[model samples]
Target chain A: MLKKRIIPCLDIKNGRTVKGVNFIDIRDAGDPIELAKKYMQEGADELVFLDITATIEKRKTLAELVEKIAKEINIPFTVGGGINSIEDVSLIIKAGADKVSINSSAVKRPELISEIASQFGSQCVVVAIDTKFENNDWFVYVNGGKVPTLLKTIDWAIKAETLGAGEILLTSMNNDGTKNGFALDITRKICQAVNIPVIASGGAGKKEHFKDVFTQTIASGALAASIFHFGEIPIPELKNYLKTQNIPVR
Target chain B: MIAIIKYNAGNTKSVENAIRRIGFNSIVTDDISTIVAAKKVIFPGVGEASSAMSYLKKYQLDEVIRSLKQPVLGICLGQQLMCKHSEEGNTDCLGIFNTKVRLFPPKEIVPQMGWNNLQGMKGDLFKGICDEDNVYFVHSYYAELSEETSAACDYILPFSAAMQKNNFYATQFHPEKSASVGEKILKNFLEL
Candidate 1:
């Protein structure tokens, strides 16, 4: 049986980790490499680095930072944000990322999904959809949840799979930073909509939220940021809880 | 030096990075002589079967890879191509393991993506790795269970998660992306 993955997402800006992580025993919360090493030690199944940095020089620094972290961490790593072209994907992957997540750029040019998928396998391409329930319908939002498109969330997910997206990182904009729980209703719907694995992101407050998503929906993974960052929920302990609950976690 | 055989497939960079992370140096190469002379050759790939094999045949890499005596580890598509045949492209493979790769039944989810546990693990390749330890896998087709199977996994059906027949070793999962358990497996392979 395939295990459900627990992922810790690190927000990076100016080539350093922002939103000071409050984990215990971690001396430096700002160093991305240090934070990454700590998360790997804590049994994080995978790591996602959202580069919130600005400028071309900062992007180069981000690559350098990724290379440094890649040397230290051995698990699967994913990088997203500002990745618009094949060169950007190649640079990040060469610097040691296993997969690259695309959002705004992919929505603007849907073929970008297949374009990257052709060069790399679909397994290496992750289409991140930021969605919000609006007007009684789930709408896909781009530009970091600022712009809403007429495309429905479920429709976009099915389209992405057809365009060769291996995985869907479905983040509910309304649930983001809420620390409530994952958007189970929409997540379950998308999981049923596509055959590819769905990674439910945003609104992970407690360990039970992870459980709710995994048991209630067919999501293969759950991604969280502040909960892990603030040491509110240690992954090893969370995995132990999931194990007891009969949820196979890695 | 370790040589990761380069063809049209992707993920060689990740493999190379993993090797480097393990404190070893490796070069991604397609040259027959380079691969033949390397201490350990990794035939890692991720792409459609027919085209990848065609590229290998075009460069005469097929003959060179077959004749090499050094230990060769194939990952994912590399493992599929080492089998006697693949259902993906109806393409005959390198025939190193005598196993036939078949597509998952249509009723099941086609690609068994994400982490899966390995059972019946044996031999040096899996040294220091625990049975039922989860390893990463992403593929639509799998090599059927056979005498060469070193590790077995059951998803849609029981299949060879890892196989070894003499110096030709292969894994249907990506050890490079499988975390510390995977790192240990790679380290053991290098030490072998």
Candidate 2:
């Protein structure tokens, strides 16, 4: 049995956390290392640092920041955003990142996943899918929800697993900042299609939403940003609630 | 010098860095002579039991580890494999501790990964550590708490958080990732 993980994602740009209201009105949260340390102390099962910048110059800065945080924190962490090549994955893994998550590059170059999986094992590779429900059909959105891929959400997740992704991180753009709950149907459908663990990202308001998602959806973990950032729901309290609900948490 | 027995474990470098942070030089190795000659040995691993045990046998480390006269420390999978037997590979362990490694059960979480409470610590490893200190753990299998258990954590069942039997000591958590509480535990092992 694997426990349901509670993760706090920190979207980084210019060495600061950019928080948005509904993913807009960006505000400075703090340094990536400091915020990550705070979350780890607060019982974050894992941390995700999304380098919001994709430009050539920003890449090095993101790697430096990742190295700083990785050196500072002791828990497992994943680095995403602008991870386009196998070299990037290898560099981050060597820099002490427990896992490297690929999004747009994985969708564009499907072979990269298997190449990485074959070399570094699937357990170290994670495929993060940003999805937006457009015209009643779920379309895979890439480039941080700026570009849309041709694959459907469910189909893309199944393909990712076949491509040797150990974990699937599904983020619902439509429900991302809604603070309602997870896309339970989408989570369940994706979980049923793929045997790999699925991490449900986006759309969490209260602590009870975690319980609802874990029970209604087949999700293995829940990831949130604003809710955890603003201290709306601390992780330990959330885990305590889930524990009372008979949901396994760590 | 602190020597970390590394036969392809993921967390060895992290442990090395942690020791360095405390002003100590450590070596990560699988060499029996180097380990046997060291004043202290730390067995660190983050892999499945079958493959790890295979590495031990492939390198003939099982016999070397059993015959170690100096203090030996095991972490996470290292601790589980120090027990009598493991269901991970249906393999026989070094039996340094009178315990058995078993799956976490299907109904419960398989890999109990994250920070959890450690209680009832009673060795030099907990010298400056307190009860309920959160230590980072990641594994699908765990060692059952027997008389050798020094500390315990509760998930689906009360499992061994730390174990001590003579010079053989083990912990189901990564003290390297455990912040100040864990740093102290590692320091205690070094001083022991």
Candidate 3:
């Protein structure tokens, strides 16, 4: 059985890790490389670095950051945020990222997903959808859930897979940073609709929430940020809890 | 020099990076002699088996790989094609290992991805890793567990995680993508 993956998302801005991370146990934690190493040591199953800054110059810096971080640490990492073209996909894959996740760019140019998939393989491309519930409908949002789009969550997900996306990373804006629990209804719905793997993001407050998403919602994986950064929940402890619950976690 | 055999697979660049990180110089090559004279060989690939196998046969790499004396490691699709046959392409493999690869039953889900534990690792590839250690896998078809299986992981059933019969060692999962556990596995193979 496949183990339920526990991922800690790092929000990178201008090529720096968001919070302080004790890397070598000798320095301050604001460095992305240090934080990434610490998380790997702490038993994070995988790491996701979402680069929120979008610009031609920032793209080069993001790739440089990915190359630096990947050299020191040996883990599968996915880098997203402002990724917009086939060249960006090529550069990131060459920069040591295992997967290149596209949000706004993928939505605007659906062919980019197919294009990247054709060149990089579907497994190397991850389609991240940021959604917010408005008037009881899940509308896709871009720019880190700041702008609204006409795409529906489930509808867009099906299209992403058809466009050669290997997996779907769905983040619920209503639940992000709230820690209420997962948006079970939405997560489950997407899981049922797509044949590809769906990683539930947004609200994950505790270990039990991890259990709920894996068991009740049948999500392939659960992702979180605030809890992990604040020490509210440790990655290994949460994985152990899920293992006992018969979640096939490693 | 280490040569990572390239069939135009997606993850070949990462293979080159892993070797570089471990202080090795490697080149991505499909040429026969370049691979034959290399100190160690890495066969890294990710894509449809049918298409990949076609490339190998077309380039005559299928023959060169079988004749190598040094240790060779295959990741994901590279491993599946090392077997006798694969249901993936209605394709036959190089026959380095005795078993045949097949797609997961239709009733069971296809493309079982993410982290999965490898238990009972018996070869040098798993020297430092334990039975409970997990490795990342991303594939829809797997080589059914056989006598050559060195380690096994259960998705719908117990399947091969790592397999070894002789100088040829193969794993269905990507050690390059598996993090610390993956790094250790790669180190073990290098030391082997």
Candidate 4:
């Protein structure tokens, strides 16, 4: 059986983790590599490092950080944020990232998904969609959720799969940081609309929220940042809780 | 020394890193001599079947891999290419293992990704690894179960998780990315 994955996303800026990760025992809270190793130890099925770094010049720093994390961590990890071209994807993959996630660049050029998918197999290409329920319709947002697009969230997700994305990282802007729960309706709709796996991101506050997403929707994975970082919900305990709920997790 | 075959496939760097983590030195190369002379040869890949097979033939790595006497392990697409044929590109494979690769039915997810458990294990490669231990996998096509199948996994259908025949061993999952369970499998291969 394929287990539901528990992923902890690390937001990076200038090669250092951006979000305040409140791990008590962690020596350097900013060191992405250290935080990555800790997540792997805590039974995180996979990790996502979203490079929130601003300047294009410092892209090399993310690659270096990826290489460092790859050497130390054995599980799969994906690198995203600011990846706009084949060269950026190549640099990260060659640096040992298992996959690369693309957002605005892909929206700007839908062919970018096909390009990366062709160069490196589709399995290495992750299409991240930032969506918010607006005007009684789910709208796809770009530029880190600042710019709204005409594309509907479900339509964009289906389009991305057709363009050769192996996975969909669906983050609900409305549910993000709310701690209410996942946007189950949109998530289930997208999961039903696409053959590829859908990872439900944002709004993960407690263990039950994880349970609600997995049981309520066909989400293959659940991703949260502060909850895992601040020790609000330890991964091992969550996995155990899911197992009891009859949700297979790893 | 270990030689990880380098071609047009992805994940060679990760395999090399995994080897280094286990306290062994390996070189990522397509040189026939280096692969032939190494104590172990790892054919790790993540790519399409036909293009990968053509690249292997273009560099004559196919023949070199087919004739390797030392313990040789294939990962993911590496395992698929070792089979006799693949439905992916309707391409003929290395024929090291007498099996056929078929695409999973669209009744379920096309590319079954993430961690899945292995069963019916029987080989030196599975030493110390328990049955139903999960390993990471990401592939759309799978090799059919055969006499060479050392381990099996079920998702959509029962397929070869790991296969072995003489010096050639293959795994449909990425052992390098499978964390501790994978580390144990790689350690077993290195020890063998």
Candidate 5:
């Protein structure tokens, strides 16, 4: 049976791991390669490294950091942040990343999704959607959640699947860094709307939040940053907790 | 020395890294001589079927691979292309295995990504690996079960998780990216 994945997302800035509340006011976490190795030892199913400073700084995701992580860790990992072109995806994948996530670039050019999927296969292309519920509807935000777009969250997810995204990393801006819980409603809606796998991100404060997202929504994975980075929740203990709750975790 | 067959596929680097982690040296190359002369050949791939097959054919790697006598392992797309046919590009494959690859029904998630357990293990490749041990997978098309199936995994349906026949072995999952369980399997392959 396919088990629910517990993913630790490392938000990378200037070669260092950092976590921010609400995608702002970022704080230093630790070294990325060390944290990645620790997560692998702790039984993380997968890892996601978002180059949070790539887009804003007009620099590509640190390929050196990606290669280091790839060399040190054995599990599957995705590299995201400033990936905007086929060449960008090529660099990261060549550096040993299993997948690459795109947000602003994909939104700016929807065809970019199909281009990367066609060039590197859809399975390696992860479409990350940062969303916020406002005025009773969820809107897609891009540029690391600094800019809002006209695309509705659900609509964008469905369209991304059509454009050949193999997975959706749905992060609720409203719940991000809140440590409350996941945005179950939007996560469920997007999961229902897309045939590809959806990873519920943001607002993961406790192990129960992982349970809530997996049981309440059809999310294939639950991703968190601060909780895992700060040792607030160790992955092995969390997996054990999930297993007892009848959630098939690995 | 080990040779990792490379031809227009993704994730070869990760495979090489994994080999290094397991304390073995490997070269990522498409050269026929290098692959033929290696003690073991790791045929790792992550890409579309038809294009990958064409690249293999372009360099006559299809024939070289079929002629290999040493232990040869195929991963993900490598496994699918080793089959007789694939519904992905409606393309004919290497025919190393007599199974057909089909797209999963849309009744569930298409890719079936993340960690999934393997069952019915019966080959040297799974020597120390336990039944129901989880391994990482990321693929939309799967090869059907056949006489060569050494292990199985269920997603939308029961499919070939690992298949073996003589010197040729294949897996629908990415063992290099499957962490410790995968490391054990790779170590087993290297030992064999």
Candidate 6:
């Protein structure tokens, strides 16, 4: 059986891992390479590096950072933010990321998903959807969840899969920083709607929240940022907890 | 020199980086002699079966790959192409392993992506690895089990996780992306 993945997402700004990563036993949590190596040692199933600073110059730095991380760690590395074209995807993948994720660009141009998939296989492209529950329905958001669109979350997910997207990284805006738990309702809805793997993101506060996301929904992976960054939930300990709960986790 | 066979596939750069990280240098090439003369050849690919095979045949690299005498390791599509045939595109492939690749049942997830544990470990490829150890996999098609099967995994149904026949070794999973355990496996293959 395939094990459910536990991913620690890092927000990178100006080529550095932004936000406080409060893990002990390490001096500089802000360094992306150092934190990535540590996380791999701690048994993180995968790592997602979201470059918040998506400028032309910063993308180069992000690629360099990805190269450094790739040289040090062997885990699957996913990079997102500012990927707009086939060239952008090629640049990052050439820099050593296993997958390139597109959110804002994908929303603006749905064909971009198929373009990357056709050029670099579906497994190389990951479409990220930032969704918010609005007016009794889950709606898609663009530009880092600041803009809302009329597109329904379930509808967009199905469309992305048909566009040849291999995986969907679904994030709930309402639960993003709340850390209460995953948006189980929407997560399960998207998972059931698509055959491709859905990675549930946002609203992960405690270890139990991780277990809840896995047990309640069919999410192939759960992604968190602050909990892992602040040392509140070490990946090894979290994996141990999931194992005890009879959850199949790597 | 360690040479990685290049074709119309993705993930070759990542594979090269993986090799470099383990304190070895490698070249990515489709040239027949470079691949044939290398101390070891890592055949890795991530693309449509028919197109990739077409690319291989265009350059006549398929014959060079088959004629190679050094230890060869194939990853994902590399392993599938080593089989006799693949349901992907109803394509025929190099019959080095004497196995066939087929698509997962429609009811099951098309691509059994993410980490999965391995059982029935055998041969030098799994030297320091153990049964039930986790490795990363991302594929919709799988190779049927055969005498060359060194390890097995159950996803939708039992299939070959790793296969070995003489000097030819292949893994359906991406050891390059599987972290420490995967690194160890690659190191084992390099040392072999």
Candidate 3 docking class: medium
Residue B25, candidate 2: Cα error in Å is 4.5
Residue A8 of model 5 has an lDDT of: 89
Q: Which candidate should be chosen as best, given DockQ against the real structure?
A: 5
Question: How good is the docking of model 4, as DockQ?
Answer: 0.86
TM-score of each: 0.96, 0.78, 0.92, 0.99, 0.96, 0.98
- Candidate 5, DockQ to 2 decimals? 0.89
- As for candidate 2, its interface RMSD to one decimal place is 4.1
DockQ of each: 0.66, 0.23, 0.59, 0.86, 0.89, 0.79
Using lDDT, give the best candidate's number.
Answer: 4
Candidate 2, residue A26: lDDT: 28
Query: Per-residue lDDT for A1-250 in model 1, tens only?
Result: 8899898999999878999677667778898988999998888888999998756667888889888877788788899998988888888977878789999999999999999888887888999999999899999999889999999999999999999998999999999999999999999999999988889999999989999999999898999999988989988999999999999977
**Arrange candidates by DockQ, highest first: which order?**
5, 4, 6, 1, 3, 2
- On residues B116-179, what C-alpha lDDT tens digit does candidate 3 reach at each position? 8888778789888987788889887888889999999888778888899789999999898777
TM accuracy, model 4:
0.99
Cα RMSD of all models vs. native, in order, equals 1.5, 4.7, 2.4, 0.8, 3.0, 1.2
Isolated chain A: TM-score per model?
Answer: 0.98, 0.93, 0.95, 0.99, 0.93, 0.98
Compose the digit string of candidate 4's lDDT tens values, residues B128-192: 88866899999999999999999999999999999999999999999999999999999999999
Model 4, runs deviating above 4 Å:
none
lDDT of 2 by residue, A1-250 (tens): 3367788999887777888423222232466776787788777878998887757777767767767776678677888888889888877776667678999999999898998876665666789999988888888998779888789999998898888787889999989999998888888888788767789998999888899889998677889989988877878789899989998776
Per-residue CA lDDT of candidate 6, range B3-41, in tens?
A: 999888867877887888788889998788788889999
Error of 2 at A183 (Å): 2.1
For candidate 2, give the lDDT of residue A107. Answer: 90
| Poorest 10 consecutive residues by lDDT, candidate 5 chain B | B5-14
lDDT of each: 0.90, 0.81, 0.84, 0.94, 0.89, 0.90
